[model samples]
Target: MAALALRGFGRRCLLARLGPGPALHQTIPMATTAQEEMRRFWERNSRSGRPVSPHVSIYKWSLPMAMSISHRGTGVALSLGVSLFSVAALLLPESFPHYLAQVRALSLGPALLCSAKFLLALPLCYHSWNGVRHLAWDLGKGLRLPQVTQSGLLVLALTLLSSAALAAL
Candidate 1:
């Protein structure tokens, strides 16, 4: 017990000589708010000529990179489209068949209808095909640069073919 007490006293002496911890806090100021902290960060980066975040302008465009970005965009678009369609279906007073008949009553030209169908299918088909490409990557395939480019091209072609076929229906 005496040795332990002596050790504790020595530690206190060492801590006092170091003049850190609570002592350091007295000399170093701290930002009070997140905004002030961010301001300090930006000021430091500005003075150092360092970018605080990455910008798309610095990246060179590539097939796989573009395909990945579009895949996300299409996925979001399809999800939003489905969600809006479901909400409209639930909230609208008219029944599905009633709206169908109303649309049919317009006697719209086939060309315009086909165009609308194609537009509707574009995102869906692209998302589906690109999703398959992503799955292939998950399976440890098409990892190389050339393979990625080829698969991206193939996905685009398949999307076009499938969209065209479905729209023709």
Candidate 2:
């Protein structure tokens, strides 16, 4: 029935598909240029101070949601950090030990050294922890909302502790 009705669209018989509605010969308005029509629509919406789509502000924050986004961010940061470090290692005239000696020569305080170590360890630790969380998810575990929240908190805690432990070294 639908196929026959669709075929009717190519003829005036489309009016019959409307089920006793107005005749097909009636005139209806159409935008000749879709671009101009869309531009006008956006312009009108802008003037009316109405949002055309949902904004980030409309979304309510949740623990798992935040952790998930941070997991991806840390993964990107770790990859970029390692790649840039490798490229710099290849291009630099000095070797790794030379750079270590240069840093030691700076005589930066232990507090500063620890802070720098923490900065280097932070993304790695977070990424590693979150990766394990992701692995668990793949194994069909910790998928419930409560378990996700608990695991997210656990990942954060472990990241902090492990990063500190690494920095201490």
Candidate 3:
């Protein structure tokens, strides 16, 4: 009886191991599917002969656009200038006036000196005036097309005048 029981158990274990436990299938490739979708999207949206969107080359230039770009540029320039100046002040010996005096001692030509001064002053003036213009716009002023154009002009004029005065000094 014991021998029969052992033989039956062994046969059951062998049948279980040989039976189909789970079904296995190959995975669908996802990367190929994604690439195909992207290609189809681009093909649908692309223009045949003409450009799809208006580029910088297609748009006409205007003063307001120029001023807007300048305002952003000046803001970045002023921020960078102030950061560098602060770092120099902390690292260099002596004080700010010492550097100024050293530059003065160089005896640089007036034209070149004034030009350097203008370059330094222009960004500050432009950023400040443009900041004021932004504030005015925030206050619900200069919303109209004409007002926007006039305010842009005023900002440029103020920037030039302030830069000139500072450079002269």
Candidate 4:
């Protein structure tokens, strides 16, 4: 017990010589909110001239990079389309047939109609095919550079063909 007391005294003396330091369990209250912290972090980073991400400005566009961007864009477009459609369905007073009839009344040209249909189908087809490619990547397949390029091309081809078929239908 005496030795332990001496050890504690020695530690106190050492600390006293060292002057005050942060406590092991010290809780420092935040002076800024998370938003302010983030703002400051961004400001610092911007001043340092560091890229915020793998920005397109720094890297030349590649097939894989484009495909990755398209995948995300299509996913977002599909989600927003569905969400807006659902909200419109809930809020709009008109029934489905009413809108259908109105569209028909427009008597849009066949080419325009087909183009619209293709646009609608394109995002779905691209997202689905790219998702399958991503699944293959998860399974440790089609991950090599050559294989990734091949798969991206295949996804594009399939998306175009499938979307065209749907548009024709």
* Each prediction's TM-score versus the true structure: 0.68, 0.72, 0.72, 0.67
Tens digit of per-residue lDDT, candidate 3, span 1-169: 9999999999899877877544324545576687889887778777454456676457787888888888888888878888998998999989988888999999999999999999889989998998899999999998999999999899889999999999999
lDDT agreement of model 4 with the native: 0.94
Looking at model 3, the pairs that clash are none
- Runs of candidate 1 with Cα error greater than 4 angstroms are 1-57
Best prediction by lDDT = 4
Candidate 2: worst 10 consecutive residues by lDDT? 15-24
- Per-residue lDDT tens digits for candidate 4, residues 1-169, read 9999999999999988877656734778889999999999999999999887756468888899999989999999999999999999999999889999999999999999999999999999999999999999999998899999999999999999999999999
- Expressed as tens digits, the lDDT of each residue in 1-169 for candidate 1 is 9999999999999988887776657676563789988888889989998665566456688888888899999999989989999999999999899999999999989999988889999999999999998899999999998999999999999999999899999
Model 3 C-alpha RMSD vs. true structure (Å) is 9.5
lDDT for residue 77 in candidate 2, whole number 0-100: 85
Model 4 clash pairs are: none
Q: For model 3, what is the alpha-carbon lDDT of residue 160? A: 93
User: Residue 82 error for model 3, in Å?
Assistant: 1.4
Q: How do the residues 85-145 of candidate 2 rate in per-residue lDDT, one tens digit apiece?
A: 9999999998999999999999999999999999999899998999999999999999999
lDDT for predicted candidate 3 compared with the true structure? 0.86
For each candidate, how many residue pairs have backbone atoms clashing (under 3 Å)?
0, 0, 0, 0
Give the Cα lDDT of each candidate: 0.90, 0.88, 0.86, 0.94
